[model samples]
Every structure is written in C-alpha cells, then in structure tokens.
Target: MSTANESATANPTVLHFSADNDIADIYRAHLPPGWSLDALSAAPDEAEKLRKVRRADALFLTETPLTRDHLAVAERLRLIQRQGVGYDTVDLDAVRARGIPLAICPHGTPTAVAEHAILLMLAAGRHIVRLHEDITVHGRWPKWDYRSRTLGLDGATIGIVGFGRIGQEVARRLLAFGSDVLVYRAPGRPPLERSWPRDRVRTCPTLNDLFAAVDIVTLHCPLTPENRGFVNRTLLERMKPEAILVNTARGALVNEDDLVAALRERCLAGAGLDTLTVEPPPADHPLFSLPNVVLTPHMAAGTRQAHIIKAQAMFENVRRVWNGEEPLHRVV
Candidate 1:
C-alpha cells in the first residue's frame, strides 16, 4: 500500500496485519536476518493497526480491512502478502493506486478449506451437530428416527458451484466418497486439468440445471461484485426439497435472509455454513435458531501447516521486493 525506503535492501521492517501473536510468530520464524517485525495487539483498534502499517516496508495481512485511509499512511510499504488466498478484505483499487504489490498465498488455502467443505456437507447432511447436541446435552438418543432424516455422500449427485483450486480439490475428495461431481459453467472457465471418471465428472449447463439435479450443492467460488448475493430466493427455489446447501466460499455469496426463509419453510432440507454475511454475527442472528443448519466460525482453512507454508511464501516475496524484484502470486 506504500513504497519502501530508499535503502530497502540494507534493512526492512515488517508489520503483522492482524492481532494474532501466533500468526505473527509463524511469519517471524521465517524472517530474513537483519529484518525487523512488529505485531498488532490482539483485538487491536483500527487506529493502532494503521499506525503500525505506516512504518513497515511490508505487511502480512489476514482479516483486517486494509482500506484507502490505511494505504494513504503506508508511506514505507512496498508489498502486502495476504496470509491466505482471498483478498476481499483488502481495498484492491486503493492498493493499486498506491503502486504497492499485492500478493496472495494460494498454496495455503485449497486443501484445508476443501476438506472442511466436505466435513460440513456430511455434518449438515446427516444432522450430526443436532445429534451431538441431543445426545450430549439433552441426554436423548433419537438414533432410529434419524434414519429417515440422514443424508449421505455415497452414491449422491453433488454439484460444485466453482471450479478453481478449492473446487477441484473438493471434486477429488468427493470421488473418494463415491459421489458424482457436477461443475457449474462460468464463462471463460478452463476445462478439468486432470482425469476423473468421465461419467462421474462433467459440467452442468446452467446454475438452474445444477441446482435442480444435484442431491447437494457446495459453493467454492470467490466473492465478486457481480455475483454478490447471487444465491437468492429464486436460485434457491430451484433446489429440490431433499437437497442440501453448503457454502465455504464467502458470506455475501448467499442472501442470508432469503436462506432463513427457505429453511424455515422447509423448501430446502438443510445447510452447512462456514461463513455468514456478517462475521461475529449478532447474537440473535436468524440462522442460530434453525435446527437444520450446521455452522463453523469461518475457519475452513485455519490450519497450522498452512500458516507455516504461507509464512515461508510471504517472506520470500518480501525478500524479492526488498531486492527490487516482483512478488510471486501478485493479485494487484
């Protein structure tokens, strides 16, 4: 979001974009010699993060919303390395305007998020969360009754809403479960890069067709302005009454109010969500009242192994920029 000092190669300072000390430590573990690091406090205020960003040559950002105001003060920033793949939290236009190289660590995200998507798919499909709550907290076992409600991945026709790295990973895992995979068609999307059973993996011509045909739908697309809240009532209505919905991509991809209405009306079977339109959702969020939904705190890709790998990439990019070279995986 800003420029490096004239003597960047001689010495450089880095800022940890978020307040997590552990994540800062992960990046610190890989810090180049003669380089210095500063970390924000846990639960830091906006002003606090801004002050730190202004003084650093590079930053390792996680969830903090890096906006134009922060960029304006980033007088010494030459590079920004997102800890994971998504960059929706950062103001990309502002970063570009400032001529700061923005890079992402895609290598850290795919497998962990893809695995969590399938976990939620199975958890929500079989009502595993409710089963645990009922038996563990209420001291009741409704084992036989559950036979009528349970959904399984085996022999199921599953639709994958996006076909990027995470989507392909999901398809691979789905195959191991004996499920057929249907990829949705988006303009200019590439063909499958690897082999899968031809009959089991192919594209669905339209969102409507995919929504109607699959036993379950899992979202793995990036959040874009054009597709924000695209999964509204009309799209949801096309899904069968027995079908389930799973979203691990971004919260704004689905219309939460519409989803709540659909769930309450029994128009859809259940939902497995790892994100909400608003993070740290208000205590009375409508989704909390539903028995047919399984929710996780947007941690689909929060693995330690991913962190170390990301830190390595982040510093390597920092070193590149410090040495007057381009950053790898540059997003803007």
Candidate 2:
C-alpha cells in the first residue's frame, strides 16, 4: 500500500478541508513543502464528499457550515481546524457527539480585523468608499458627489461597542487621528486607559453614555443569543442624528430591518458594514439602496499577513492533534 494509505490505515491521519481560496493557499504554505492538500471548491454531494473525506483525521473549514452530517461520515476524524476566531460555522454539539476536538486560531485575525474596523469607521465617517466608487466607477471625476458628505475624525468621539482585542486595536488606531475614544464593554470589563494614550481617550460609564456621546459607534462585539439584535430600533434611536455606525465584527449583531428603517428616516448619517445580517445580503436587500451605506463581503481579514497568521494557527492546532496533545483554541 502507498504511504498515504499506509498512514491512513495505520495512524488514520490526513488533513482534509475547504477554505476560501486565499486562506487555503496560506494553509498550504504553512504545511511542509512536499505535503499535499485536498480541497473541494464547494462541498460536493454527501456520498461523494464523504468518500473524499473518509480517510481524513482532521478537517479545516472557513465560511462553510460543518453540520452533524458532515462530521458523521469522517469516521477517523480527530480534529476540526477553523481558520479564524469565530466557530459559529462549526457545530460544537456535533463535534462533542463524535468526540472530535475543534480548534480555532487563538491569536488570529484580531489585529487585521481591528484594522479593518478602523478603516470602516474612517470610510463611513468620510464617505470614502462611496466617493471613490463615484470617481472610479461612475466617471464622476474631477468633482465630488452633489450630495456627498464627510466627517472630520479630529476632535470627534469614537465609541467602541466591545473592548476586546480587536476593539482595543481599533482604539489604538483611532488615537493617531486625535479623536476622543469612548468604550462600552461588559460590566467588570471596563476599558484600560493605561494601555492607550490617556490624554485623548476616556471610558464611558455606560453603554447609553457611549451611544449618546460619540460621533461614530463601531461594533467589535461577538454575536450571541442575548446580543444578536443589539443594534435594533431602540439603540439606533439613541444615537445622534449625524452619528455614523460601523460594524466589522459580525452580521447578526444588528437588526437589519431596523437599521434600514433608521436609514430611511435619516436617523443615522451613514454606515460602513463589512458584515451583514446574512452573508452576501440578497441583491434586493433594502440596505443596498441607501446611498450612505458602505457594504463589504466580510473582507476585513483579507490581507495576506492575516492569512499567513491564520494558516499557522490552524497548523499549530493540527500538530497538537497529531501528537495526541490537546488542541488550542477549543470552542466546544
């Protein structure tokens, strides 16, 4: 038998997976030079996909949902390696049922994601993306849009909705612009002003305080059942009419319908969203019609550096599994 078969029959280990094109390349680069990787552009039909995955010891995924059925067929599967922080795409309960450890990149993508959030904030504040599209795509060169808008970052207050790693990094970048920074984090997890320049940024006493006081509110929190619709009508109503909104964190955190209504009523000045309530929001989604809303296809961690870090993180976890060591970044 061939070495692959010998290994599969003897150790039952193979790295099986799917990931975005760029992420997949990074994964490949992190592996040994001669190692081969199997990839599926899209998960094929069940029997076929299972046949392709049957001998695998681990699976790596990004974006594609890994349900119970997907895991059930991989009899030798020992680990599930996720490319980034969020494991929502991988069903934890299913992994538990099969006794497979799930791993994610622990120190992965936060810096890149944080940078992306700051970029979104600036883009939204200044209508940067919209203006660029007008100049390049619509041939509106040599001038600005008749209804164009802009917000000066200097002397403005930026409210961070979550003060996690990415949120703190966003705060770090905001400091360069001399903007006043206010943060709203879970109780007992207040902002650490010492970690950042104390002269400019300050911590808010409450979430409402941050919402009421800032010129721009950027979301950096995760999506959970309790906070899924956190940015609904009530919260949107609390913002200053001219306050801009930015979310690079996750989609479900905001109530899309309420946001659309707020935009329609002109309650919000504009928004920059790298994520949406659903990935690739339907073409007819109401948010698309708003001239002030800037939407990206969740490309915040799209940089090459971020991709390499993610790949390394996944490989580290795979190595741990191969050696019978506990996987890092276990989600469930």
Candidate 3:
C-alpha cells in the first residue's frame, strides 16, 4: 500500500486511520479530485494522531477511537465517516456536542462480515485450528479421533443474536447449509426492513432461550451501553456443553473472562472470536493460550473487496458533506 500523503494540497483533506495498512493504496486510488488523503502512517501516538486531525476537513474512521480531545482540536472537521456499519469506537456524546455528523458506510459490510461469521462457526465447530496444529507441530494425525470430536453445521441449530442486515445475511447462508436459525431481536427495536423465510427461521423470545436451543450461538449485535458484556457467565452457562460461540461483532459485546472460563471448564465446546475487548491484546491474554479458540485480529470485514467498496462510499459521503448535504448513512 502506498503512503502517498499528499499533504501539500490546499484542497479539502480527508484524514483516514485504519489498522489495515493495505487499505491505504485503495483509498488513495479512489480519491476524489482535489481532495487530499492523509492516511495515518504506522501506529502513531495519540498526540500525533490528534495533530493530524486538526487539519482534516472530514475524518474517515476505522479502528481508531475519536475522543473529546480529538474533536476539540478538529476545527476544520465537518464530518466523521465510519468505514463500516459499527460506530461503537467513536465517542457519540463528544461528536454530538461538537455538532458534527457521524456517518457509517454499510454498502460492503453485510456479505463479508456475515461470511466471516460462517467461517468462524465452521472453524470453531470442527476444531480446525487444533487439528492443524496437532499435525504440523506435534506430528500426530488424529484422523480417527476427529470423527467423534468435531461437529458440522449441516444439521446444527444456530441462534442469531441480532436481526440486522448482517444477521439476516448470516441466516440466509446458514439456511443454505441446512441449518435452522433462531433470531433474537432486542425488545422495543423498530420493525425489520425485511422478513425472513419461515421454513427454517424463527424468533427466540429470550437470549437464554436461544442459547439453550442452539448447537451454536453467533453474535451479530452492536455493542451498546445496555448490551456491552451481555454474554457474561450466566448467559454462557445457558448453552449446551457441545455448543460453540461465534462473534464477528464488537469484542466488548462479550465478557472475555467469562468466555475464557466457559471454554476452560469445558462447559462450552469452543469459540471463534474476531473481535475482543482489546485490540492487539497483551501476549499473556488468557484467550491466546486456549486450544479450543480460533481468533483473528478483527479482520472479518477487512477483505480488499470490502475495503474498496467502503472507500468509494466514504468519498461519496465526503463529497456530499462538502456540498452541504447529509451523508448517506448518518447516525448522528
């Protein structure tokens, strides 16, 4: 990815910060005319990052948290556009206090993120990582044991925690795999934009009910104040001993300690976690040592295709903001 920071341009500058460095080239390649792109280089300090934001007319955010301090100095900032659907990292109160519109680009998220959730479900269910390590590192081929140890999605019951676009997409894919879906929508939420097929899709009145009924529980909900760490000890204990957990959503949506305990005690089969309470968790993080866990650096939606689509949408929103129009999916 190119670090072509055309900082000299007097045109409107859009500052972008993302953990995926490869996305820089794509964002620069799709740059709107006369708009400068400042992709924050390598992991800069908080002070330096805030300094760069001072000159930005719009902030294209991902991975980085925008706090009150950053917004205090963002005098030129007119808008903040999130690269994907979740805006949990941004300080909503601070952004609102500043009266800056915060937007999220969901154009390329549903399919990629949902597909990743499926990937995790499969990998965790089958203990793919453990088998691979056993063969490669230990020189043991547990072929016979694999049959009795692993599970498959074909006949499994899956509980989907949120029924948003990504959740619905996950249900669609799971149905194709011959799995049943149990959806749990939050109470008092607005009606779904679309309905699901009745043949394999049904609603679970409560989260505990869904956890108990399914062979696998995959979380697709956002991390809000009310739901943060909702997947705690009590919830984890509700699942069958053979059931696994898959989370492609925000890491803090789960309680890391509780999840670790469940996996350690063999009360839960395994977990496929793409997001964690902390990004770049310490080397000594408990989940790092668990054999039944499959973890990624929160890259479920980090595919090049998704990033390209996100970049285009972000620039289009930037254009709209400059034209004195609201962004496409403005959340605040």
Predicted structure with the largest TM-score when compared to the true one: 1
Q: Show the lowest summed lDDT stretch of 10 residues, model 1.
A: 1-10
The whole-model C-alpha lDDT of candidate 2 against the native structure comes to 0.76
User: lDDT for model 3, on a 0 to 1 scale?
Assistant: 0.86
lDDT of 1 by residue, 49-148 (tens): 7789889988888888899999999988888888888899898899989988899888878999999999998998998988899999999998787888
Worst 10 residues of 2 by lDDT: 1-10
For model 3, how does the per-residue alpha-carbon lDDT over 54-102 read when each residue is reduced to its tens digit?
9888888887888899998898888899988888778889998988989
Q: What lDDT score is found at residue 148 in candidate 2?
A: 42
Q: Each candidate: RMSD to true structure?
A: 1.9, 3.6, 4.3
Score candidate 1 by lDDT: 0.88
C-alpha TM-scores of all predictions: 0.94, 0.88, 0.92
Better structure of 2 and 3 per TM-score: 3
Alpha carbon deviation, residue 141, candidate 3 (Å): 1.8
What is the Cα-based lDDT of residue 202 in candidate 3? 85
Q: What is the lDDT, from 0 to 100, of the residue 60 in candidate 1?
A: 85
